[model samples]
Target: MSASNHKDTYQATGVFLVLMGILYLLDKWIGFSSHGLPWVMQKDTMLLYAAVIFLWFKSDKSVGIILAGIWLIQNIGLVIALLGQMSAYLLPLALLLVGVILYFISSR
Candidate 1:
């Protein structure tokens, strides 16, 4: 990658960090309720945002995609709960599918 690309990547990372810090401060000072906030604004969404930034500004996208997939897998239960779905085995089944897919993809 060119120097410009490297600079952009660093700038994006810095901006993300700064924004997260500001959000953290706001949450602390204003006492925002986590349940009342949108899912995107939740603290756990930082990883998703960082993954998006990595995909957008980085030359290589594989790492970003992998991180995003992992985040989805990790939070699948939360997503299902939010959607008002109550399947006891859904989380495990989703995880198993993701694992199989990842295994196949990595073998190529």
Candidate 2:
């Protein structure tokens, strides 16, 4: 397939993922039983969706990677807090790691 076609496919897949996540959240909002951890968080879920959308549109992946990294840290921090293992350093450390990953990905 052509490069354009390949990019289109990725964009389509990203849209699908975001739509699915939104639908799931809407269902939960209406008191549906998700019966488990959400596919995404009630808070900061937009980061993931926006990251996917941005990644599809931009040649540089850093924006998406950074957003996704922040999202992951938020969600995981919530879980860790619940377990009483959360730390003040987690956010900085996670952000640093994400920045490194973004630099490497963008450099390629």
Candidate 3:
């Protein structure tokens, strides 16, 4: 792929990563969840952002592509988990919409 193509994909995935990341942080810090745990700061969840960074650093299609693949997979799982939750319908829908948009943009 051309440099521009890579940049576009990065831009899309980067946006997705940042938005969800902030959402997670806000939910935790603002006491949105009553479970005494921040959803975004979870150990495993942080790996997705780390992978996003790796995707930025990786120039090779193999490594970066693999990271992107994993990122998409993880995002799908996150969307599914969120859908299963008891939160208001709109929030989950918005999250799923973002996830779908991210995956669609990232995969291209």
Candidate 4:
């Protein structure tokens, strides 16, 4: 394949991966009930995923990493809450670690 075609394939794969991740997260958080997609996924979460996918596809690493940190925290908070571990304060600490990692990654 030509160099440009190879790059386009990589970008398309990235977009697909992002979408799949978003769908997985959504399914984990909110199972498909009697209602459909519209009522299943949260608006803010969808928008956040959209931003992540867009930035990633555009090859904007720094902003994508920052947004990914936010997404991780949000999803981890939900999981921790569901497991009744909210009193441990681990969610915030884990988020802090994720933030630090994101900062370091963006700096590079």
lDDT of 1 at 25: 86
User: How high is the CA lDDT of each candidate model?
Assistant: 0.76, 0.68, 0.65, 0.64
The residue ranges of model 4 lying beyond 4 angstroms of the native Cα positions read 1-41, 69-77, 86-89, 102-108
- How do the residues 1-108 of candidate 4 rate in per-residue lDDT, one tens digit apiece? 477655754784577567767777768777655347663356557556655665656444555556665675667656666769554786668768878987997999
lDDT score for candidate 3 against the true structure:
0.65
TM-score of each: 0.57, 0.39, 0.32, 0.39
Global CA lDDT of candidate 1, please?
A: 0.76
Q: Rank the candidates by lDDT, best first.
A: 1, 2, 3, 4
Candidate 3 residues lying further than 4 Å off, grouped into runs, are: 32-39, 49-65, 68-108
lDDT of 2: 0.68
- Per-residue CA lDDT of model 1 for 15-104, tens digit only, reads 778878887788777656754765646645888888887788777677678878778877977777875655567767877997999899
Record all residue pairs in model 2 with backbone atoms less than 3 Å apart, i.e. clashing. Answer: none
Point out where model 2 deviates above 4 Å. 1-41, 78-108
